[model samples]
Target: MSEDAIQAAARALSAGRLVILPTETVYGLAADAGNPEAVAAIFEAKGRPRFNPLIAHVATAAAAERLAVFDDAARALAQAFWPGPLTIVAPARADGGVCDLARAGLDSVAVRVPGHPVARAVLAAFAGPVVAPSANRSGRPSPTTFADALEETGPSAAAALDGGPCDVGVESTVVSVLDGRIALLRPGAVTRDQIEALVGPLPADQDGAGEGHRSPGRLTLHYAPEAPVRINAQGASDGEILLGFGPGVGDPRWTLSATGDLREAATNLFRLLREADREHPVGIAVSPVPMLELGEAINDRLRRAAGFVG
Candidate 1:
């Protein structure tokens, strides 16, 4: 990481400007969590709704504790998965300086310590919590590379830190540890089985799905592409692009993983989606991915991308 780049990003963030920072999962459209105006810029830049909250990325577990009151379970999960892709949603500290706009005016706040070195350096340099959603336009595929991030959010941001491609290539696994019970809000690279081993069986749907937004990625139509999407497809329609997995019938425009490696497929998911969508196809058809491990996260994104309700 360049010191000049880090300093420039820190300066922009301190000046209440947006910065595109990379994480282990995906690049984020970052803003100072304590600044309401900065947080509002994120919403306006992405055309995102106010009801959807953003994840506050901190430098360390101690930093996260300052923003949210963690219970024993929350602490265990944090200790086991901090500086990683696990986002813990806990009760917000009443005195915590996170602005209401960043949390969508919710009593609870979603916090995480990113594992990316560049992100950590920027956070440490900024010396404050930074709330960042995926560095893309609202309802668009999350950018996995800094180049892609710059292409998506650059014009709207003050600067972007290039950290290459995201390793995990998916959002963090979000769990709400509030209300004394562990609820799985959104599945990502951190498998439910891994979380369950630590916190016991999680509730089926603990996320409050009503009016108020408890966490990000809860929106019905999100992570969408420009073209219409169709899932569980064995092949593509006449003018559609087929995004295939494993073996397939006709020639696919792109393949998530020809070898059927879920991890490889996960890494390629957004990149391939963005590629296929660039063609301006009539629609994008996706082959069925097994509902296991990283596949769950893939399917979750696919379902939302296709605008499926249930």
Candidate 2:
């Protein structure tokens, strides 16, 4: 990590200017969470809807507690999953600096302690909550690499830091620990099984219209590419590029994983989506990925990208 780059990003955030910061999952369009005008700049820059909230990144679990009211279950989850790709949504503290615009006018705030050293350093240097959404335009694929992220949001950003290609390559798994209950809000690198092992079984995804205020990724047609997408495709159609999974799929250039590894597939998901669009295929066909564990997050992204979420 370049100390100068980290300090520059932190200074940008402190001055209420938009900056791009890298995380394990994706690069983010970051702003000072306590500054409404700064947070509003993010909404304007991305053309993101006001209804969709943003996730506030903190330096540590202790920093997270200052923003949200956590119960025992929430604490347990945080102790086990913090410093990683998991966002805990809970009641907001009256003095928590996250502004109303950043919270999408909800009483709850979506907060996380990122594991990426760059993000962590910026948070500590900025010494406050920062709201960071994917560094891309609304309804587009999240950028996993610095070049792609800068291309999408660089013109709007005042400063940018490259933490290299994101290893996780998907957004954080969002779970609401509000009111002493744990409910799945959105799937990402962290799977449901991992959470269940720590805090007992979690219910199905609670990211519906009624519960949308509490999560950032509840949109119906998010992570979309310019070209239309076809899901569960065993093979490609005419003028379509196949993003394959298992063996015999043939197109290694676009293959997520020939050996059927879910982790590799997840890491490559958004990158391939971006590349396939660049190829200007009439449509993009996707190989069937099993809906289990990490696959749940992969399928969720594919469904939204295809604009056919249920």
Candidate 3:
């Protein structure tokens, strides 16, 4: 919340430079959305596929409205989840003020109003849209800390806004509305059930894997870690160590929240991943947990970190 830091970040964005900014979910590499050249810098910096697109970060609902055409459904979702981890993809009006390239050449632009004070401050000062995605090299783990981003993105970033750790520690839930239907492209803090409760039953596959279905976050091989890690329940071999969610039965490499609570597990997942990387084990295994509940997101991250198919 430093005014100096906010001013420095605003200047970077206006000058067509990349700035690492924090959000509720993860740190993002931000560039001016109205400038195609600035937006292109993000793609080049991350090596991100142009087809994948980027999210436009805004300071308020008014700012977001200037970027895309929002229907009633899109407005409902925004009102309920704005300033949090949610991105709604709707058709970009021909007169939409954002750059078309920022939407990956699609008719819609992904937009969100971040909850972090520093991020909000930057957006307000810039007084325009900021196109951003996870602040890491393409296909690497999303950075939760400024130090980690510096390691990957390097000093090319004009400034890095240190917002401490991301609370959600993942990407936003992306809901796309096209052709008069609601689709969920990716799932995160917002669940399908929650969306359904408000909007009726949503399409099972929002990314369109099959007929009338669209897939979100279904991309194979994502959310990876720098080190070898695993999920195990009992003790481990000489090289392999235990990441215990319960009492450590014997010699161990690391034990996390031995009480085994899912909420605790989610909060500790990245920290443990970092610790495991530092230990540099050949592999780190997690104890198996039920997949129907909190275990779902936990396993999602672990599988992503381990580079295993989820």
* Tens digit of per-residue lDDT, candidate 3, span 149-233: 7776756588888888877776777788766788767766666677777778876554433311122233455655655666545
Model 3 ranges off by over 4 Å = 206-218, 228-238, 241-257, 292-295, 306-309
lDDT of 3: 0.73
Candidates in order have lDDT scores of 0.89, 0.90, 0.73
Q: Tell me each candidate's TM-score.
A: 0.96, 0.98, 0.86
Candidate ordering by TM-score (highest first)? 2, 1, 3
After TM-score superposition, the amount by which residue 83's alpha carbon in candidate 2 deviates from its true location, in angstroms, is: 0.2
Off by over 4 Å in 1: 206-212, 248-253
Could you tell me which 10 consecutive residues in candidate 2 have the lowest summed lDDT? 204-213
How well is each residue in 181-236 modelled by candidate 2, as lDDT tens digits?
A: 77888898889999888888777655533564688866788898899999999788
Report the lDDT tens digits of candidate 1 across residue range 1-68. Answer: 89999999999999999999999999999999999999999999999999888899999999999999
- Ten-residue segment with the worst summed lDDT in candidate 1? 204-213
Maximum-TM-score candidate = 2
lDDT score, candidate 3, position 57: 88
lDDT of 1: 0.89
After TM-score superposition, the amount by which residue 102's alpha carbon in candidate 3 deviates from its true location, in angstroms, is: 2.4
Q: Cα miss at 23, model 1 (Å)?
A: 0.7
Q: Output the better candidate (1/2) by lDDT.
A: 2
